[model samples]
Target: MNQRLNRTAVVKRAAELADEIGFEQLTFTRLGRALGIAPPGVYRHVSDLDDLRRAISHNSARNVAVVLSSACAGLSGHQALSALAQALRDWAAMHPAQYAALQIAPDPNDTEGQEAAHELISVFASTLRSYQLEGNDLIDAIRLIRSTLHGFITLELSEGFKLERPIDLTFERIIIALDAMLRGWAV
Candidate 1:
């Protein structure tokens, strides 16, 4: 007998699988087996591995945006930046696998995927205005901060730190570096 499946439930399950097993290893076969369905059965929800990846990335990005938006609320300038940076770092630390999946760039043609990706960056860009940023400088600053936080978290999660210094200290140092950069931001 064939089992019935809910589309929403399947996508949620597939998303969980993506985080647990990593995006690259997520296949319809694996998801179907886990869900007690045939491999082809999953085709009703996900067309292929790429579609599955897009779904996973979209979910992860949306979750990150929720966290970031909450953190930056009612704050401005350095305070906003600090709140956002810490929030992003904390989210990434807690959900390393999900965070990694969220880093995948979405295809511009994929409307859903693009909107998800936009939410993530838009939150940062909006918080950036609290710094009195504008034009190319604003764009550049946002890129710098995002890259810094993302790179640090990615490296830390991968055990890339080689020094005897505490990881906490390294993160603090990063915040300080960003603060200094922002202080001279308009120059």
Candidate 2:
């Protein structure tokens, strides 16, 4: 533990490294090497590997939420939904690990982690409201859209598509299908 380092810097670098090496490959030793500190020094900033993972999750959620929210700004209904869909895909393409981080369920007692997750979902929930959906229907809609987008993006990131069709075209069709679903979903 030499030189000065803080949890914030450590977390930031870890998140970057997560995007670089995949979240599973991220390790304190690698992070330490990048930070020019001993692996033990990371303990000074974060309690342990799990704690650092939590911090990364929180950071990733918050960042993704902001990106998605901005993408849907001043738009509603199908337009908002489409903006959100494309933005999410673009963000995931750029930061697959961070996007994957959003999939990690927050611990029940982790308020900060819970809040970050909620904010990301809220972005989708708000856009769905444009279709005049609410109550249980709204919750279901959010889950559906999240699941749809998550499944598609995950497969795409993993190169599971393996088709000759342009990926963008498939994504656009998905947005069109979602728009149609939401329009009828209002009833």
Candidate 3:
């Protein structure tokens, strides 16, 4: 706790606070309290609440891209897709608030944010290359995968799945379906 607090450290702590207290509840005041400093002290690391949120968003995107890239490493086709899907779901389940942060569109003018976002898409595109997807096809496939994962995770996080069957089974089935669709994709 005696370590010097910098922007990276502050943002890392803020991400933890978000996971613990929910992203919507994450504020400079709360982060400052958690850091054992006055609320105004947070301004040294982040300009304001929006700045803090943007930092958290960028960090969240990086975290997710790393996870997905690691999962898909040395894998291809259905194996790669399955690993990526599982990684995405596991990351979201483990860090709901940080995962929620990824839902926010990054500032178009922010280079770091743009790079982090592109990193994620690059992972997906690399994995889907086995399907011979390129150009608009690759873009569409990325959107499909992202939308499907986001929709399912959002619902799961909100406890919207009211079913007698196990949720894990459903998630696995969805991945299987996605893999099949991608294999036969034409457009």
**Candidates ranked, most accurate by lDDT first:** 3, 2, 1
Summarize candidate 1's per-residue lDDT along 1-187 as a digit string, tens digits: 2355766677778877766777577788899888888899888877777777677788888988999999999987778888888898888777766787787888878898899989988898888775677888878888899889888888987889989989888788787788778768875
User: Which residue segments of model 3 deviate by more than 4 Å?
Assistant: none
Report clash pairs, candidate 2: none
Q: Candidate 2 at 83: error in angstroms?
A: 0.9
The reply for model 2, stretches above 4 Å from the true place, is 1-4
The whole-model C-alpha lDDT of candidate 2 against the native structure comes to 0.87
Using lDDT as the measure, name the better of candidate 2 and candidate 3. Answer: 3
Which 10-residue window in model 2 sums to the lowest lDDT?
A: 1-10
- Model 3, range 12-92, lDDT digits (tens) per residue? 999999999999999888999999988898888889888888888899999899999999999999999989988999999
Cα miss at 140, model 3 (Å)?
0.5
How many Å off is the CA of 25 in candidate 1?
1.9
Which candidate wins on TM-score?
Answer: 3
Q: What does candidate 3 score on TM?
A: 0.97
